[model samples]
Target: MPIPDDLHIQEAATLERKAFAAMESGHLAFRQGKISAMELFLLADKWELAEEALRCLEKTAQSS
Candidate 1:
């Protein structure tokens, strides 16, 4: 398997951070009645995906 470059790892980290921020925003929106429960769930999924991607990249980087 090919190892991820520094740029790829950096991008993955940034994506995870943005996903977390978006999830937090979604929670605030839900609390304020600005978004539906389904929307919040979708944001949670997005965060999970980002988190997984970052973990995979980090693991690959470490192994290589």
Candidate 2:
């Protein structure tokens, strides 16, 4: 079984949006001193991973 292209694209877009939202929340938390620098760095890593995942999805779709 395989994921349909439309669904895959939608999933990728949703993940990317959530990743951006998480990054924004992390920034706000850091600015307000609610979170530490290390925590913010972790959130940044998450966003980077999301970006990489999106790129992989796009590449896979292109090949398909």
Candidate 3:
């Protein structure tokens, strides 16, 4: 069955959100020193997550 265009948009948004959530988790883990740099690289690779957390930080710095 073909998905509707509206549904596709929603799905894409959901996927982007999921990616961002995963990146947020990775950021926290990295900050807490619970995960090493190598582990972070592996986690990001395994999940195919974007650098959403890093982007957020960059935006904050630019605005400030």
Alpha-carbon local distance difference test for all models: 0.85, 0.91, 0.66
Measured with C-alpha atoms, the lDDT of residue 22 in candidate 3 is 79
Top-scoring candidate (lDDT): 2
Q: What CA RMSD would candidate 2 show?
A: 1.1
The number of clashing residue pairs in model 3 is 0
Per-model clash counts, in order, read 0, 0, 0
TM-score for all predictions? Answer: 0.78, 0.90, 0.63
The Cα error of candidate 1 at residue 63, in Å, is: 1.8
Relative to the true structure, candidate 1 has a C-alpha RMSD (angstroms) of 2.4
Number of the top candidate by TM-score?
2
Q: Write the per-residue lDDT of candidate 1 for residues 1-64, one digit (tens) a residue.
A: 5645776678777877888889899999999999999999998988898889888878776776
Residues 1-64, model 2: lDDT tens digits? 8777887788789989999999999999999999999999999999999999998987777666
Per-residue C-alpha lDDT of model 3 across residues 1-64, encoded as one tens digit per residue: 6545555455556666777677779889999999999988887875564445445444544454
Give the TM-score comparing model 3 with the true structure, all chains together. 0.63
Report the Cα lDDT for candidate 1: 0.85
Give candidate 1 misplaced runs (Cα > 4 Å): 1-5
